[model samples]
Target: MAEGFLRPSNGRMEDEGNKYFNDLLANSFFQYVKRNECEIVTSCKMHDLALQVSKSEALNLEEGSAVDGASHIRHLNLVSRGDDEAALTAVDAKKLRTVFSMVDVLNGPWKFKSLRTLKLRRSDITELPDSICKLRHLRYLDVSDTAIRALPESITKLYHLETLRFTDCKSLEKLPQKVRNLVSLRHLHFDDPKLVPAEVRLLTRLQTLLIFAVGPDHMVEELGCLKELRGALKICKLEQVRDREEAEKAELSGKTMNRLFASLAHKQGTVLSMIFWRVVCAIRQKW
Candidate 1:
């Protein structure tokens, strides 16, 4: 984890981080698994000898007597095997800052006031407690790969949130109408294309919008206002756009978007010709 060691100040710093990873690979500190000619390193395993050394060093650095429980733990990761809800509910991590739950169920009267990041990936949580809105200091919230059908309207009260990720949550149909109130949001990753609100244009600070579906209320031209968007962008339901002039008004060339995909709900050559293909060509050349 290059968290504190690497600060991405520019492109060169990112390259340096990659170079450091490669150096570890070359030294056999990290092993690669190959499929065909492609090699992908999914995880790093510590050698038994190395693990012993690290454990001894950690013990040496320990300054205080062992606590009775995890009451002082600031970061908690709960990986549920089965029926671990009772164990999870018993935790009294009052000073917690980060909580990562890779579980199927999360039952909570959760009251972590200082919590900043909460990740509940692949969880079976159908709904979040209204108490979540009380975490004013929260910044990163991820509820991806879950069965949550809807978010409580009180979620709009998190004014300090910077990243809100709900990718692959197929059951989620819509976002709160007042989602525009999250003025600090910089990244919003969602699955349902139609869930995007017409007021998305007000999120001028947004940078990573995964998908945008053009509809009667949210026109293609609304994308033009998101000048800060970069990386990949998928524009679905292109059949709704009237003509090429309207598509061009999205101003794809003005931003730093590298990968662009445009899809039509229905195959209409005239609409595709006027809006879709031309936009793709413009993006291909711009990047």
Candidate 2:
């Protein structure tokens, strides 16, 4: 609905686009369910009548709908209810641009040629099938909070991928070493701080890198090359920084980083002073 209201002159909406949402709440179209201590509504439950009306207009291919009538469907969400495995197994939506699933496990020799976004958050998928590399057009993928352990090396073939998220995937021990080949990558979210490789300097287009652990293989100076970094950055094991010169080379002040958290393994007065001054400079620039 907000997309429909964008101005024809600029293709952008002037407001935050909450007017329709407020109107719905005012007219009792949606029931408020939860609120924060500040009295801000946090959750809303749509009236059953509205839900039914929405389903009546949308084609849910997962509900035993015929694929013959779904060739034009651009979005597909496969929500499993234990018995819905057969429904997922029968899906053949090649034209689908988005595919989201919330299932314990996905059983597939799957193929979606045109898919651009794939999210399988919290699923029991332990590994991505080799066929996933065939998605040449895939741009966004989130397998966060899952039981995955390792990603196939073929994942490096996703040259067009822009954002990859695997936060809270505790069992994942490593990422493809050639991940830097993804030149288009802009956002990378991971749970383990040590998982980031020094080769990340190759991803000069990166904007959001949540946790960076300084280690023998990944030096803090490597961060100097990532001038596009934004948002918050948490650099752990700061003791690995060789000297003040190396810290200066990180170029933290050159970027638009808003928040920074540094954990030092050493408490030497000189080192601490240098780090403190650099951080203060960065913070001052942010302000």
Candidate 3:
């Protein structure tokens, strides 16, 4: 392991042998968790640091004394707006793994075996920890309204995840390459043009596939591949104006996009007719 360096909030680096701030951080981390719930283990260190301590004395101590294993931490939310330290300090995520946060929550491979759902919407998080993929029992993951740019390659490990929402994740650029492994996903939502790469055709089990910048001319053929689509899909593009040529191409692709809708509309029935009409209107530039 690399030696711990004392990097303070003022953007200055201290000596690696500086045990003063290091011990201060350890104490502050422990005190922060104690002040919050006193029943969970939380820390403000980066995932690397948190993971290090999580596997070492700090987390083990918390597990033994604060909470009985990972069973007590049922809900966790780190602060949405703060310096890295403040955000890290707010995270008391310990044994009770079923968690909800708008912060970067996955500090380490989820050790809690009973965790089933995780919600981290609007937390300004950027990357998902690869350790998250270890949660085989996870059923829900919401990362809406955050600045998250992409998912980890290991995301396909969540075999039990059913509802995955990424609403308003403006910076997200691509889905995990292993997304095909998410055969259990029922809802996949995003509205960033960068997020809708052609690889999206892999999600065959998606019921609600929301995208940005869907045009009649842009891979309408791929829409037919999502055979499990049973709910409404919304396509959004910001600031770009729609023209007649775009409308015509969408009208042509509308035949297929609408057919995909027909399969889904059958299950949802008239409730979706209006929604599909709105979708068609958006694609056709009638909006």
Candidate rank order under TM-score: 1, 2, 3
Model with the higher lDDT, candidate 1 or 2: 2
Q: Write the per-residue lDDT of candidate 3 for residues 194-264, one digit (tens) a residue.
A: 56644556666665665535444345445556665533444443112233333344332433233222112
| Highest-scoring model, TM-score | 1
List the candidate numbers ranked by lDDT, top first: 2, 1, 3
Model 3 clash count equals 11
- Tens digit per residue, CA lDDT, model 2, 1-287: 21133334542132233456677878887896576543335589988787677553233544544544444456666655343445434445466567777763235544577778888887768898766788888888899998999988888999988889999998899998899888878789886886895488889989889888888888777788898887778888776665566677778877866678777655658756676566545433524
Which prediction has more favorable TM-score, 2 or 3? 2
The candidate that wins on lDDT is 2
Q: After superposition, which runs of candidate 1 have C-alpha atoms over 4 Å from their true positions?
A: 1-68, 81-92, 103-107, 269-275, 282-285
Q: lDDT for model 3, on a 0 to 1 scale?
A: 0.53
Cα-based TM-score, every candidate = 0.74, 0.72, 0.49
Q: Which model, 1 or 3, shows the larger TM-score?
A: 1
Which has the better lDDT: candidate 2, or candidate 3?
Answer: 2
RMSD of each: 6.0, 5.8, 17.9
